[model samples]
Target: MKELMKGNEAFAEAAIRAGCRFFAGYPITPQSEVLEYLSRRMPEVGGVFIQSESELAGISMVYGAAAAGFRAMTSSSGPGYSLLQEGISYIASAELPCVVMDVMRYGSGLGDIFTGQSDYWQAVYNGGHGDYRTIVYAPSSVQEMADLTVMAFGKAEERRNPVTILSDASISQMMAPVELPAMACHDPDAPAWALKGKGNGHFKRHTSVMYYMNEYDGYVRAKYEKIEKEDQRWESLETEDAEIVLVAYGISSRICEEAMRSARAQGRRVGLIRPISLYPYPVNAFDGLAPRAFLSVEMSALGQMARDVALACGMRAPVYSMLGGTRLYSCSDVEARIGEILGAAHGAF
Candidate 1:
């Protein structure tokens, strides 16, 4: 049904609909509503909901649930997500199918409960240890929170890898109209590798990454390469004939969308590339936009995404970064930044 729903609530409903039978999480701001909503709804739907003592414990529980061949998930913010890193790495190593949602908040250590994009690097690149990547989704709106979450689960299960929904306080707390999908039933058939009890008359084999190190490394690399080729997702706007392009993701993409409209109206040639899959990172988005200056806008003190843009563009164009920190950019702010970059380039002319 169509209704005005908070992003957290929308995502919780989506998880349920996506056949997420197990939810394990610790409450953290900007995302606490997800846990709270799931807590009340899970029991009604015959699902397991666990309020773990700590973020570490919560992700550990998710790991166990996922290993059992169930659609499992967890949610948290910055520091809490930091605590889940080891478990995430283990999940990656074991190639477990699961979903993790991070409603990003500010700071290195409990900076603030406010929204921030500082976690982009952590979400897309260094989620955990030992050269692995998860399918990361950046949702800009409440509706996308629901939609991409369903996609996240599907992708994780399809690839037998973990997927992350990397949102922020703005997207997590914002309310917007959304249509909930019909709930799907969770399947209980254990995978060939899943442990079955002794009485079940099956060989109970446990999942682990302890094998030939070289072979394991090669296997992981091959899997990631296939994901990179097939899973890169992005939206390009006005880039076919433009001098300046703005690259962004998550909520910043929404702001840039507005800015693009305004800039086009004002006769300033500005385009945009919004990355929906941050891990695979739409490098193709930068394929032909050479001889143009690029602006990477993000909500961080340093432009973590700009680094990726530079690499994707092959250092052919000058890439600039605008760090918004915890503050969201107004359309005017984006236009002004575009003007600054364009004007500076013109001055060089």
Candidate 2:
């Protein structure tokens, strides 16, 4: 059965279904609903939910709960997400499993509560001080909010690292029908490294000291390599013999798809590549493609994802950007940009 749900609430409900027994987070616009939903739902499921005094405190609580072998999660928007960096670094260093969500809002320093995709660099590049990487998922729809939240918890445990759901204000607040996953239970004693009480003297857990070990470098390298090789995910549309391919994710990709369809209807060879995973970056999606140009569509003024597209395709062709700084542009706007790029390629002005 599908229920009409908002993206934030869907994500929260899905977390509980995925066995997320502990949640700690502060209220922030565009994502506060996540905390609110979990607060009421957690106790009903016999789980724990805490509305921490601050984002820092919330993430710290998540770290402690995750270390105890429980499925834990936290969420916030840009500013609050910034505060979790230190705790996220600590969790990464400890190799603990947890999930985090960034309901991105616009701007750099205290950007307004408008929709934005400007956090691409921060989330993918690890804003915290560390030699670490967190898996990032960019969802374009409300259904994905539910689906990916469930997958994130599993992936976090699988990799023993934090996984991030990178959503924008549009997706977070939009209402759509979603068929959520079934409820699952997680055992707190499942992980060998969990901090059990004194009765378990044989197994001890140490965190944030991996750098001191001789093999730390090799271990970290291998882990990320495997993830990069096997975890890259994307959705390619009509790229078989396309001369132009548009790359985007989240709400931006939704608009790009519309543009691609419009361009194709007019007999233009346009395609789209929607990245599902942002960190590994879905570089494999570019394999065996030889388009004349690549266009990066984003909601940031700087075209933050354009560079990654260039790197993935090895600059085989020119990469263009259709940027929407603080708001979404129409499909016709994207089509106009494509026209400009095509005209420039043909030296038509």
Candidate 3:
């Protein structure tokens, strides 16, 4: 059944249905509803819910729960997410499978409670210390917020690492129709590496940076290469014969989609490439695309994703950026920007 739901509520419900039995998080703007919804619902299904005093403690709790082989989760926004990075690093080093939601907000330290995508670098690059990467999912709509949360758990476990659902207050606070799945059942058997009850007189210690630290980098690199090859996902629109291709994701992609439509209507050959997995980044989306120009639209002062786009496209085409901080861009604003780039490139061709 389809229901009109806010983005936070949708992911919370989806997590519960995806067998997430433990939730630990503090109240933070934009994502507080996720904690609120899970607080009441987790207990109904015999799951554990914790209202940690701080985001640090909350993510720590998640690490503990996941260590015990339970599907665990935590949610927060920008500043709070930064505080939890230490725990996230530990979880990554220990190779624990868990889910984290970052409902992005604008600015740094005590920034506004409004929506922003400034955390793209934090989410896709150095989320924490060390040479580690978390699978990052960028959900543009309420339905994706829920659907991706469910998929995150599977991906995390399949890869035996943490996964981040990267979203912003805009999508978190907005309401949209979503079709939820049935509740999932937990697996009875704990993972072989988990610190479960004594097994055959063997002791298990879940430590950060698995034994043989020297070989750790090689191991992680192999996994990341596999992820890059196997997990890259994206959506492309009208790029077969286009002069400009817009690279965007999350909430910004929605605006760019509108811009693409308007540009097409104006007889401008424009297209879009929206990355669903921000960490893997879907670099192949631009492979072999002979566009006249590439524009990256993002909700941040710095063009974080633009750097990724330039790297992905190997600077095959001139790359441009349209930045939006706290406020989102309108279709017309993006349309105008696309026109500007295309017009400038017209003379070069």
Candidate 4:
């Protein structure tokens, strides 16, 4: 059944349903409600909720708990997310399974307590260091907040890597009616490769790389290659004969959906393709769609996905973008752009 709730409330419920037993976080604007709600709910379900001193410490605590085979998570805004990147990198290198919510707010440096997609580049492209990649799940609404929370944990455990439920404060603070799925108890054993302790001294320990060598590079490469094969999801609408395709993710995609509907009302044949998972990008989906013109709409200033889409779809489809270090455009602004692009491209098709 669905309930009318804030995005933060849905986020907490989803985590609980995903069998998250441990949550550690530092309160920050836009995302504190997630911590507050989980602080109460986690304990009621015989789980753990810890409010740490800083985002750095909070993520470390999550790393520790996840290492012990408990589903765990942490939430923060742009600044706090930056603080946690170091811990996130360590969690990546250690191959620990965990989820992080980045309810992004405006900022290159102290942007403010407002909504912004500035963290798009950081979340998917590596804010901390190294070649590590985290599965980034962008949810546009309250329902996605909860649904993506569960999906994030499952992806993290499956990949033995970090996963992020990336969103802007607009989404975090917004209230919407969201139909939640039936809550299911988390199954720790659902993941096959979950590091489950030393196993009664009968198995070798899963240790972080202490000694780096050429072979380790190859080993990491193989793991990433396997990840590319296994992890990928992108949703589409009416692309069977679409000449112009709109590519968006997270909240921007939600906006794009509204834009698409309006454009259709005006007799445009535009469509939208939403990438549910950003790290293992759906390159094949891009290829299969094969639209004449592709445009990207998002909340960041021309970040990771746009470039990734270009590479996958090739220059055959010219790409236009309307995202940056500025405010996100509205449904009208995006609809007009997509309408123009689709109209121009439709002529050629």
TM of each candidate vs. truth: 0.95, 0.97, 0.97, 0.89
Clashes of each: 0, 0, 0, 4
Order of the predicted models by TM-score, top scorer first? 2, 3, 1, 4
Better model by lDDT: candidate 3 vs candidate 4: 3
Sorted by lDDT (best first), the order is: 2, 3, 1, 4
Task: Output the TM-score of candidate 2.
Answer: 0.97
The alpha-carbon lDDT assigned to residue 330 of candidate 2 equals: 85
Which segments of model 4 are wrong by more than 4 Å? 186-207, 210-214, 342-349
Tell how far residue 324 is off in model 3, in angstroms.
1.0
lDDT by residue for model 3 over 258-342, one digit each (tens)? 8899889988999999999998989888889999899999999988899999999999989999999866788899998887787
Best by TM-score: 2
User: All models: lDDT?
Assistant: 0.86, 0.92, 0.90, 0.80
The lowest-lDDT stretch of 10 consecutive residues in candidate 2 is 200-209
Superposition error at 44 for model 1 (Å) = 0.9
Candidate 2 Cα misplacement greater than 4 A, ranges: 209-212
The residue-level lDDT of candidate 2 at 188 comes to 93
Candidate 1 accuracy as TM-score: 0.95
lDDT value, candidate 1, whole model: 0.86
- By lDDT, who's the top model here? 2
Candidate 4 lDDT over 1-349, as tens digits, reads 5688888889888888888999999998989998889878988999999999999899999987877778989999988999989988988888888999899887777778877777878887879988688888888788878888888887888788899888887778888988775666775555443456656755534446535445778788888788777777778876667767888886778788888888777767778888877777777677666677788877766454688778868777798877755666899999777766766765632
Clashing pairs in 3: none
Candidate 1: stretches off by over 4 Å: 198-202, 210-214, 326-328
